[model samples]
Target: MTTTSYRTAEQIGHTEQGPRPLPALGVQTAASQPSLVDTVLPNGLRVIAVRKESVPMVELRLRIPFAGMDRLHAARAEVLANVLLTGTERRDRAQFDTDLAAVGGDLSSVVDPERLSIGGSALASGMDVLLDVLADALTGAVYRDEEVARESERLVERITMARSQPSVIAREALQKHRYGDHPFTKEMPEAAEIGEVTPEQVRALHKAAVLPRGALLVLVGDIDPDGAVAAVGGALAGWQSDASAVSLPKLPDLTPGDVRLVHRAGAVQSQIRLSAQALPRTDPGYAALQVANLVFGGYFSSRLVENIREDKGYTYGAHSYFEFTKDNATVLVEADTASGVTPAAFWETRYELGRLVLSPPSESEVDNARQYAIGSLLTSTSSQAGLCATLVALGAVGLSYEWLRDQPMRIADVTAEQVAEAAEKHFAPSRFTGIVVGDADVLAPQFRAIGGVVLP
Candidate 1:
């Protein structure tokens, strides 16, 4: 038998000097602009249709501004989303699934504090069927008592489980600390509140908040753009209301303060959440800020990960990302570590945040971040589903396909100096405040020694 000789994995991965240098990122190029139509129906629903023929399937996303100010709105809204597709006047739950499955389609609805979203997919040949089913639910969901009761019980159980998680506990503490009692902070409602949401309340909410006006519908796939818009308009003609959907009230501005140390009794692990106000996507400074953010901690290779995770072994992972809501945006840095390492991780996180502001990024670092920002954007939109989701997000902020088509050029245009300026202006240590959730008994001494944390 003849055997082929081969190098071991370690041998192939290194050179005499050290590990091999990574190849420089290639010249970034823009994707070809897709054929598209964007128009508002007479009933005030904006329809965006883009023809992406990569696959013989279509993806759909519908977003309605579903914000409400009442204290119990979250609970009611969650129930509504859970049962929205359970039954319509035209079809019950079984029939609804049967009809969509017959056309190789499925749809799901979810709600957050800001909006109610419906997403679905189907073979391109069954696009019409998908739209029909969506329309049937939007215009005719009955909110049957049995369906409401069933979903409520299930939702309460889920909420109970989720609230027990350390991450959920940390997030709740952060939101409340940042924006006290704001409707937007109530992302997950109380289980007791969910248990009390009656079917009549859900129906009332649907009738009042599920209006077509001010909502957006996006469709991307192997279909004619113009024809898709026409189909949507025809199918949803009955999903009309004289009033527009409810938008969340503007969020209160965040202020810098001492980080709150929240006590989670009996917890052995800890969550550190840090946040600071940042520019929105619509801001002219956003591109430069985006690059700076990537360099700081937005990706696995970022400085925070390299420092706290790779070097110090303080946490398994660390990340920083922007959270956008309505017209406001904020950057959040997060890490989870054992109770013993939590204080060290928090200190290093704060150090890195300040370092980005004072030291800024080197020219080489800025270039790498720029390449990553542009490349990730291109990769995210390379598929039909991705493009559809992107359009929905951009549309919510009043941007269109043209904005997306030109985003690469925008990222590429950012200079190192611009990125540095953004870093200094936005990422100062004094600008951030957040929470650390852990066994305070274990963390209080170290955190107090560190001097910026407000212990419970």
Candidate 2:
């Protein structure tokens, strides 16, 4: 209904329209890459500063490889991240918040089995204060009893809620099935065990996991690169420790095998999680593999989404992508469906997987995916926040902003034949393994008929 308007249709300029076609090729890339200042502090902290000069803000990212010493380390690190910024010897929780607010900044910390990462931003002029506050937290976090108690309880509550989620359940099952006793399996810790962590253990964990030797700090903003790097050296010069920074060893290659059934009795939906070994970003043909994934299922326009969602209505969405760890990479394919249609979705996913190798993508498919991959990379790094985060990953692999800026041209150079080869090598259905989470009585018999299940 129009509400006292001349006419809604007229205002909106209504007209019949048809879908538009994608544009032809263009030499689109980042206009120019940011100039960079890279250096290492005496304390063994690698600082990478990029001169973005777009806005008066600086984004900071610190990556400390927080690999757990053992299974219990994962639980302790969880609690540590939650309470890390809660208080420090120089300031209580409230004071800490006030100081950061003064600098137009906020900081947060999180830890996985691979790394303990701290990220935040501040006004460019207030960069010194930001660094000071970060240094304070690193050097003198108190982990007071009351704050630890409160944050631990909150962590438990959050984890409890997360565990109840079907997606989380599926992921947990997949990790357990894939890596029975691997430290990587500790990515998601048990909530009950996490809640039992004490303040002293958190202190010990901070000491062990947060060493600066070989750690990386990435800063991007409107600033002079040389001065910025030198400033960082002065500010964090004291963040030294005799202990080496934590790092994970290489991940074992994935071997395709039978699907493990994780029966969720009486569930209304099932989540299919499939993964296979993949190439790291540094590997040759990785750019082609990246494009190949996009053509298969990495984007909404890909074959998997076209078949499973738009054409057949098996699920609301389906996607596949690569996950890079510190040591290795894995491709993940996921889709959620009603319990009754679970088998159909599974069949189509496997069929798509097999077809990728048997038939391969067309020239059009390869080009479209390449364009998207390039456009996304350029756009994502176009801002300070984006570039700051990008630098950390790049830094981890001993790459730089120059490499990222050149990636679009590198991607455009990838040919359809290369993508096809990557598909044949990596996308073969026989090269995948996974688990299905649903009602056993309903799904068990169906899965068994398809093969790859042990009879009870």
Candidate 3:
């Protein structure tokens, strides 16, 4: 064999003096707008269709507000989502799969405290079949006893396993600490609740909660926009109802206080979760706040990551991100570290939060973060699936494609002074409250000495 020569990674990366500087970002070109139709059908469903033409497949997303206040509502909703695609009036379970497989189509259903969402894709030529099946399920799904029982058994097992995970335990503690007794905190039903869910309860919930009114359906693919909307209107004509789907109750504003320590016995690792209320996407200052969040811990190059992961060896990963709910929003910071180093990690996290406000991000730091925010937005929506999902989220909050197309400009306009202002107004260590979950025996003494932490 002939020998081949290659430069080593270190040789390519370094010169006599140092590593090479990265190339500057090129000017961003605006994407051409697609043909679109946004209309409310006679049956009250909002259908948004766009001609992306990037691939020969179509992506679908449907969102229905499905919140409730009853104690067993979560159990019923879980069982309902799991068994939604099992069968309909016209097709049995096998027949449903056969029809979908013939068109290279598949669908999945998932529910949270806010909404019941269904997402799927199919070959462009099979869009009609896909819509027909979806409409059939929405209008006439029969939650047969046997199918409900089987799915409930499987869900019980999954929920049981999930509740045992340290992440899940920490999340439950954080939710309770942040928003106690709110229906929004009922994200996962207890395993025993699943056993009590009956076929009749699932059927009743579908009848009362899965209405067409106030629901949104988004379709994007290689098809005519107007034609797709017309097709959707025709397929879903029979799914009419007078009552609107229920939206989740508004969340209470978070109260900042001492961090609570939750005891997880025998756990070798610990989770640190913190939260603070922030502006919604609709707020004028949201762009500046977004940049500030990026500089703090939103990305790998953030100060929190550099200080804790790169310097202190505290954790393998850390991140900060916005969690949006309807018109409300909050910024959350999360890091997972070893039990032995948990207190140090907590101290560093608060120190960085205060530092972001006191010594605001520099001009270079703001520029890098602004560029990342704009670049990530464009990259995420370049694909048809991503576009469909993004539209669904925007649509849920009374927005549309215009807001998406205009976001890059919004981010580009944010100045360093604006970022500083946002950081000062939002990132104060006193404006946050959360939970530190680990073995109390291991974490108590160190956290007590560190202060501002409530013991078990």
Candidate 4:
């Protein structure tokens, strides 16, 4: 084609693939990683501080381990998170909101089986006020009856809607398949229990589970690390408790087994969620396995998406990711499809899983995946919000700023052979147990033909 005949991408932007294979990626250079200052206050709270002067804003992340004694605990904890900021002992809900808004700040709370997280942000100059407000809430949340009642009703409505969704049903069934009756399997509480919860129960949970002994706080912004630490230490001096926080117990290793068919009565679609045990970030081979996951199903250009979505058109989307727990991690794959095509989609998924382990990915595939893994991390951490969030997660796994700074080089150095080895060890179809949530009448016959499916 001559230059005169060529058209811009706006005119002809489709099918950029060439007839020949693409070249492998070469070495990558990155900007200098940021410096971090960290300290553990005498009260045993870990504070991580980083100076990012690019923006005049500050970000805060706090994670506290929240353990429940029984299934009822989930319901109570959910209510507590919803109302923790509604009314402190001194300020009413409206006043608290107004004060935070005055400083361009906001705080929100989220509770799960693993932990209770409080994420907030403010202007750089309002940093001290934000910390003071957080300290006040920690020490003196009132959990008023009227506020609790209102939030409780709203939570029940939200949960009921969530429980009816196909994705939620599939996720709940998958957790059950993996962990049986473990407390972690209960993602949402029973609506009836949530309705019965009183304000008193929430206060009790707050007393028992919201201690600061094992909490992690990550602060990033355009502030001096030394002064920020001192300010935080002074503000939170009274937010201490004698009782130690309870961390979740270590989960048992994932065992590969038969597929389970969960019958969703009269459903027109199916959700397939599958998983296998995976290495944690601390593992020596984790970086390579991350690259391997990207090549398999972690990205749009992956082999799994190519075979299942683009080629076969079995589903609109398919995604696989790693879920990290305090004790371990697992690889998860999920896709939803028409009820009639569910069996074909599941078959292709398993076939791809087997093929990933049977043969190594091409050199070009390895290079693309490796670069994606490295590049995404750099882009994510360039902002204060992103860096602080990443810091909170890394701290949960006992990693530090040095680890985050070195990850790009580690990912860039991963070779095709390393990714292949990690794939063979972790991606075998036989090593995964999965669930098919759809009409049993439509799915049972097809799943039975393939064998290894247990009916319930």
Best by lDDT, which number? 3
lDDT of 2: 0.86
Instruction: Name the regions of candidate 4 deviating beyond 4 angstroms.
Output: 1-26, 29-33
lDDT scores in order: 0.92, 0.86, 0.93, 0.89
The window of 10 residues in a row where model 1 has the poorest summed lDDT is 19-28
lDDT tens string, model 4, 1-456?
656777654345344563234354466665465656788888888999889998999999999988776758899999999999988878889887887898899999999888899999999899988998898888899999999999999998999999999999999999999998887887789889998899998998888889888899999999888888898899999988877778887888889988899999999999999999999999989999999899999998889898888888899999899999888999999999999999989999999999999878988889888878887898999899999999999999888888888888889888999999999999999899989899999889988898767876
Ranking by lDDT: 3, 1, 4, 2
Task: Write the number of the candidate with greater lDDT, choosing between 1 and 4.
Answer: 1
Q: What is the per-residue lDDT of model 3 for residues 158-275, given as tens digits with 9 covering 90 to 100?
A: 9999999998999999999999999988899999999888898899999999999999999999989999999998899889889999999999889999999999998899999999
- How well is each residue in 1-456 modelled by candidate 2, as lDDT tens digits? 867847553234433553233576687655575578788787888899988888999999999987765757888898889888988878888988899999899899998878889999999998998898999899889899888888878888888999899999998888877777778777767888876788998898888778898799999998888888888887887788877887876678887898887888889999999999998887878999999999889997889998989778889999999888877889999999998888888999999988998888998888889988988887898899998998899888777777787778878999999999999999998888888898888887777787765433
Q: How close is every model to the real structure, measured as TM-score?
A: 0.96, 0.94, 0.96, 0.95
Better of 1 and 4 by TM-score: 1
Clash number by candidate, in order: 0, 0, 0, 0
Q: Global lDDT for candidate 4?
A: 0.89
Candidate 1: tens digits of C-alpha lDDT, residues 269-375 = 99999999999888999999999999999997689988998789899889999998777899999999999999989989989988998898998788878888888
Q: TM-score of predicted model 2?
A: 0.94
Residue 253 of model 2 has an lDDT of: 81
